[model samples]
Target: METKFDSTADAVAAALRELIVGGELGGGERLVERDLAERFEVSRIPLREAIQQLAREGLVEVFRNRGAVVRTLTAQDVEEIYGLRVLLEGDAIFRSVKRLDEETLARAELVHRLLGEAATTQKQGELNREFHALLYGACGNARQLASIRELRAQVERYERLQNTLLADTPSFQDEHVAILQACHERNARRARALTAAHLDSARRIVLEVVERLAA
Candidate 1:
């Protein structure tokens, strides 16, 4: 059955993701289907569908009798995600920079400036992804970008630990500027190096929070 907020499973999943990412839904907390259905004004069918979506994203876990609970990510998960990011995004930016003109790099710079002015964590996250997409979309491989997007979605669980992790810090500001400058210079090797360093730095920043949570 469907309800006002449950127009589609994607809608319900997005609602649930906001709660999880914003930390309202604590890790390991059991998801009571009946309660959530009532709260979201949706029927069990769509609510279940939403939970399943989150499960695929590694934010939810389901068991035969125990039902679903928020997944508690481990330190290893952080390592694996960022490791893959280094490979995927680093290479994409390398290819992208080789192909993009200075104008495209300037477009990404515009977003980078707005990223500096973002007031909230949510806005910061949005601009950050936008900047990357604009910066790397020129990689010209739809399949590569699709995989990168999936990895990014998975990393959002860690990224949203923003109270403890660095989301829009000055370090990020400086780094984004540097990366864009490299792109402006049309230095594929330098851009790839910067991207790799950026991903590693991010892995370190988020790993601290995730490891403690794991322990």
Candidate 2:
């Protein structure tokens, strides 16, 4: 059976993932174990385990004795992540349309509601993740979904950074609604095109934001 510590550790991991994706904790920020342990109301052991898990996900880097830090994304990381996003999500949308059932589409609609709420409140980054995951899961390709999910997590760090700082970017809700509409119509081709376009737009916006921050 899972202990209370296990559950607490998982919660802390999720919360930290959100902070990272939301850019509350910026890139290269040091992760102090004891501080996090206190914040999460847990002990050091579980906190260390959570950090280790994040490291395996490529979202954190653990130094031998210096402790863990958020990984700093390079331009190359953004390029590769977006490139893979286009290939995987674009194809997944196409496949999903063919296999998607009414039930699945309805679930997707609900997920989009969450996305919209997130966008409206400027808390939609995580909801955006759920929206995409619902659509991708429809593809029924385990390996492909796994690969794309990893890429999504990697790029999301940058997306959060961009979204948090930009007051002028287009509404992410609208972008997601357009994709959902395409899926609702079962227009596979159009969905594929939109998926690619959405990712491309996100890449451009996020990269520009990163550049601005650097400047």
Candidate 3:
């Protein structure tokens, strides 16, 4: 398939995503196309294209009279996303655990350790993502994996905000260790339960941050 985006447009979109997620753009800030074009040193075409891309990703929305603005997510969004995560991720990991290979297990162990030491939200998010992917990637369901990735990208901003600004990120080391042990023991049921609880704990922590921010 032919790519729809040029390098500059893609770069513009990525930069915008970072700014918004990093809280540099601030929630509900108006995105004036001309101002953004000037700021990014890009033409109107790429700037508008980048906004449109973020819109599709649920990171930006345009009011009929308000043009484009950063989206201010709600507690409901967090609950819905992670409620689904419990089901989707639990099922995926359950399947993957039954099929785990030694190499993938080793990689996951290292990622879990890195995640424990990850001081910045960006590094923690990256390492945590890798650990989850290693756990779930063997599920034999490409579509499910893709959908989870998209949801994760949307939810990551809240996660980073919660951890980096509002409160210390909760350590998942115990849960991860338990889950890994269950997987190694070939106990799929225990692994699935642990994953569900893990995601639910995350949902609660993120919502606490969202409430504070909303206040």
Against the reference, the lDDT scores of all candidates come to: 0.82, 0.76, 0.84
Best by TM-score: 3
* Candidates ranked by TM-score: 3, 1, 2
How would you encode candidate 1's per-residue C-alpha lDDT over 121-194 as one tens digit per residue? 76777888898998889898898897787677666656667543344468888888889889888888898999
For TM-score, candidate 2 versus 3, the one ahead is: 3
For candidate 2, write residues 1-215 as lDDT tens digits.
Answer: 85455776677888888788766788889999878888888888878888887787778999998889998777777888888889888999898886778887788788767554444323565556667877878788899987887677766666655344234334555677788888888899999998898888888767876677667
| Candidate closest to the true structure, highest lDDT | 3
By TM-score, the better pick of 1 and 2 is: 1
Candidate 1 Cα misplacement greater than 4 A, ranges: 1-7, 101-103, 165-168
lDDT-based ranking: 3, 1, 2
- In model 3, which runs have C-alpha deviations exceeding 4 angstroms? 1-7, 162-170
Worst window of 10 by summed lDDT in candidate 1: 160-169
Better of 1 and 3 by TM-score: 3
lDDT by residue for model 3 (14-104), tens: 9998888777887789999888899999999988888888888788998889899998879998888888888899899989998999899
How do all models score by TM-score? 0.86, 0.80, 0.87
